[model samples]
Target: MASESAANPPLAGKHILLGITGSIAAYKAAVLCRLLKTAGADVRVVMTPLAKQFITPLTMATLSKNPILVEFFDPENGAWNSHVSLGEWADCYLIAPATANTLAKMAGGIADNLLLTTYLSARCPVAVAPAMDLDMYAHEATQQNLRTLARRGVHIVEPGDGELASGLTGKGRMAEPDRIAAFVGDLLREKKKSLQGKRLIVTAGATIEAIDPVRFISNHSTGKMGYAIAGELAGRGAEVTLVTGRTSLPTPAGVERVDVLSAAEMYDAAVRAFDGADGAVMCAAVADYTPESVSETKIKKCDGDMCITLRRTRDIAAELGAHKGSRLLAGFALETHDEEAHAEAKLAKKNFDFIVLNSLRDAGAGFRGDTNKVTFIDRAGREELPLMPKREVAARIADKIEKILK
Candidate 1:
């Protein structure tokens, strides 16, 4: 048993605060607690009053080997369960089987229960695994609440798509116990301050070049990839500045955001920020060209074809590379044909330390998607990667940067 614990010590000696909410999925918390214990974590269970109806506290206590906490104080002994103390004691606070009501309350800052109160007081990282009916999960209000939490740096373990308690087939099932445990372990295992004191600049999204007040030119860049990179760098303790174009995505936690509308604006922002940055990731899909002149008003509909003169926009990555001086600069290339050749050319022309290449012809490897397939090109050669979540790709990028820094 000792050797087994030593063999998988990613979460060993860590304090975990497990909050179970009111949902039929609460029964799964028992298995989760056991798995966490087997992984060598010190597990403490906090349950909502309603959660007791779904699963008994005794079962949880037996698995976790700790007393279950349901109320603010123990009535039998009159011992107070200090939410602040619990919050301070944990390394990570995980809420599983989070119902719509609990999620809404959490979003609204209503801390009527011990678990919610602990959440409000927790200085540790927070995560949630939502469990509810498909309809409730799909509701806009719930999604907005989830987004709000995500913006605040709460890790959301996305629910799986499968049969629900209401006999509906869709999302909103809490992730399985083993998967949840692995996720939490991964979070705890990450080096929290690997790039401390370093500063990085990242540009993201589609730059809009206006031809008229009502008409503009832009690509399909949604900024997901750039945002993920920024978040990853921030997680590694680098002070990140995100120069972003128009997109509704929330700013990553711990990142400074500079909003811009056009390619020229993004160029100015990225250049200014890069002057103080230790490195930069050129992830924005900046426009290659923009209109030479702007129309003051919306162009009236005409029967004849219209033409607008365009000129090349300033190259942000090239300018940064010209002044790179020992500073690291990474660039991205999205191509349709001769992908490797184009990427290689850009790698040399931009003076990038390395380049990330993704081809449009490859499915699930382009803009406006959560997943990407990429290859890393450098003077040392290439490293091909499989299709993965953008967040994972960001981690790989961050890893490379760390190695370079080392």
Candidate 2:
């Protein structure tokens, strides 16, 4: 196990602050600390005063190789345990086996304990694993507190549904140590600032073609994939400019959004933003053609079919490609047939560094879905990916972008 852990240390050099609250499940914190240590993380344990009854500080300190912190100051020596300093040192703060009382206190901003005070001062991502009886877990107050914490960007590792300490066979069991360790590792991995100081442009959603005042033509794009990419890049410390068409999705954090209603407007916005961008992801489902002339007013129902001449819209990707020069340009191809061939052609024609290809025939690979199955096509070759959440896909894309930027 030691050799295996050394071979795959995902959290190497990461500083993890582990918080243990009062609960029978506090016993699991020792195992969690060991697992985190095995994964090459520097672990520090902080315990609530009430937690000492269930788990000994000596055990945690032995596993973590760090002194246990339970109080603000040591009465024996008058040395201080600075919560602010601890908060700043940790890459991530994890509260495992968090009791209902601890959850409530965290949600309410109560900082009576050293762990709670550290949580309040921590600037890093915070995660909690709730553990309690089924009744306490299912109560509306608890649920509301969880929701409130979630809205405040707290990562919640939901309790498992199994035998509880209360002798009831239901939900509200704290997740096992292995799962908690994996969650912390994954969370810290995603928080890496690989693209820091880079500037990126991303286009998203379906561009509309207006035929009348109240009627317009658009595709089924919900901007989920593009928004995910923007969020991923921003999370990696990139300055992102999102040139978006019509979509109800909220702007991703740390991304500057430019909203447009039509393909022409989107083309203008994207082109302008790309001038100062280091790279661009063309993910918008832009219209190939738009009405040459729109009606002055709403077109009433007519017996004969109405005819409106259409003209091609400006190709945003091709324009960006022409001016991309040394900058990276990535585009998406949503195809019904000959997916690879079309993607490759577009990759060359638009001078894209690579193209993401998705076939309409594949289930969950198209627009309006939270999941996607995609293949990356570049001059080197192709890399196919399995169907997964849009966020994961975005991460993969961001990883590739980082390689190019580096």
Candidate 3:
């Protein structure tokens, strides 16, 4: 029987195929192998021919508790190391110390060795941790190759910036063993389709209200929270529609994005998406007012102070709430004073199933930041959450959505 500690690990019972490539960082593969094993994964090692020179097969074999594979067949016995079988058995394929040469080959679909062949055959998710000299890592070709792999759904553990084997310092160092192991564990955990068959709408970023052709009023919201929620929903198999304002964030995987610039535009898109959605997360920082009369051209710089008229924009959440019927609706409140009161008011006013409340006075709790301290408020009561990463907050929100859906 497996030990309690071993069985309780995040990677427990998972089969991991670790690929090593030719690089000075190949020596770190031994440590990575050990970490994966310690996390209760059944690890098997595959190495390129040149990788053997940097890290001995015996070292990897001892750590993995399995023979390292380097060729298609054993020279002495003619026994085959079947790539197909390896591919089928693994829950994840991790290529650590993935050299620039190997990355290019992977990008080009070159299967010249056992490791590459296994990668081509693998049915599981593939993750790569790149390692190379600073210049090589910065080269446009390498960047393009990495982008290609990313577009094909390969998980990339971005290289760290530090001293390289070439006696120079810059980005291209492979991530540490512990970090790599944790990333693999996370990748596997995210594969669970907990939200399958559900459709969701997420509104994100700060809506722009134009005052002139070049000048617009917006907020500090970067759409990080909303984007994270959308990503989390999509990861759990929810069909997500992201209704977003101006932000540079890429669309999350498996999400349909509808771009909008103004509060009016967002209101239109959100309503349309919400009609077919199982739930809606109203996370955008929308402008409450717009210029009553927008100037067609840029306003001239005048010595005298100018006054512009303002009008209230349409309330997207309230409109959706009125017509929600059986659909779930979640709203966010960013407050500075009387946080709980404001949140409860919004929760009641918008008829939200629950409202996520964050105080701007609390450090790292709102807008343009990566962390948040929030409270989930409903008619029953409030559940306060500690300060945490925005992604984790998104997960908690997703958990609530899942329960309401069920």
Candidate 4:
């Protein structure tokens, strides 16, 4: 394909680390690697010992123009090929033909091999495309492993349903190389240009209110949904500034990140960014109240019970609503009771264009997970979205923004 005729392959400049495991689909990786190279990405190949039974290291090395690393150390001199360095070097770690065994190891944190070790150390995004025989793919163990990896932040490139290696037709075939490349390109592109020209500010995670420097009140908010939304928005060509309270979640690609602590700090950061933003998603679980005053030092644990004074924290959304005009404001409410009534009141009071509501009663959602099932409410009514990956949830929110802005 001509450089211009190639549709500006989104893989260009992506440092893609390819992992080939023991599977019949391993052969397809050669073509996949070549296509990735043609698209202008820097490719590096990693092989499992079993992978050698299917494909030659020399073949992969020649195709990638880089040495292949299959083990932690070279057998000849015992020189180390550091998994840490490999993890640090790549922009993305991709496993094509990821076998059920590898998926189980990845999900279970079994680091018996170099590939698994590198996976644990990788700082960038990890995506896996599984390939297997029909029955093996549909087994309960395999399905559980896949879900475990998904929950642990690994992207599963869903396998296509078709003829399998065992001559049975089912959903075990790895996606075609070209389609996998396209999917990866979309993933990378989603992190880069999808939100261009639109300004978005998202608040995420939980706020910490101090009773003293040594003690603070917080919650179980992982901020996965908020971070995912920020990432998807940035990928779609939006300039995003993420105003967040404390959370372990990494900052999304192509986003300007701001970290805050107490609700007061969050309020300050969010309102400041709202001015320049075309829209804002208030997703952080900010504390409704905080200690009225702080002790100069840690409060000593006494034999008797103690009472502390509490005060209402400034309502962030309401303050923003007072000033936000025509800007698409999105709010999230986690309700345990009277879900609709509370959500509706919040929408009207905060002047949000729409509100996303999820219940504590719902499974696969809330804190510390990748999946979310939500009900999105606009002034018109509600749309109940099925349980979906948080990333998909982000896509839906971005789609709504696109509709409103368009």
Q: Which candidate tops TM-score?
A: 1
Candidate 1 per-residue C-alpha lDDT over 33-142 given as tens digits, one digit per residue, 9 for 90 to 100: 98889888999999999999999999999999999999999998999999999999999999998899998998999999999999999999999999998999988899
Candidate models: Cα lDDT each: 0.92, 0.90, 0.90, 0.88
Candidate 1 RMSD to the correct structure: 3.6
Residue 282 Cα positional deviation in candidate 4, in Å, after optimal superposition: 0.3
The local lDDT score (0 to 100) that residue 6 gets in candidate 2 is 68
TM-score of every prediction relative to native: 0.84, 0.63, 0.75, 0.64
Q: What TM-score number comes out for model 4?
A: 0.64
Global Cα lDDT for candidate 3: 0.90
Cα lDDT tens digits, model 3, 1-406, are: 1223553877788999999999999988988888888788999999999998899999999999999999999999999999999999999999998999999999999999999999999999999999999999988889888867865778887677788899999889998887788778778873679899999999999999999999999999999899889988988999999999987665666788899999999999999888777989999999999999899989999898999899999999999999999999999999999999989989999989999999999997898766899999998898999999787899999999989899
Q: Model 1 clash pairs?
A: none
The model with the greater TM-score, 1 or 2, is: 1
RMSD of each: 3.6, 7.3, 4.9, 10.1
Q: Name the 10 consecutive residues with the lowest summed lDDT in model 4.
A: 1-10
Off by over 4 Å in 4: 1-17, 20-44, 48-185, 188-194
Report the C-alpha lDDT of model 4 over 57-161, residue by residue, as the tens digit. Answer: 999999999999998899999999899999999888999989999998998999988899999999988989999987888788888888667656687776878
In TM-score terms, candidate 1 sits at 0.84
How close to the true structure is residue 109 of candidate 3, measured as C-alpha lDDT? 97
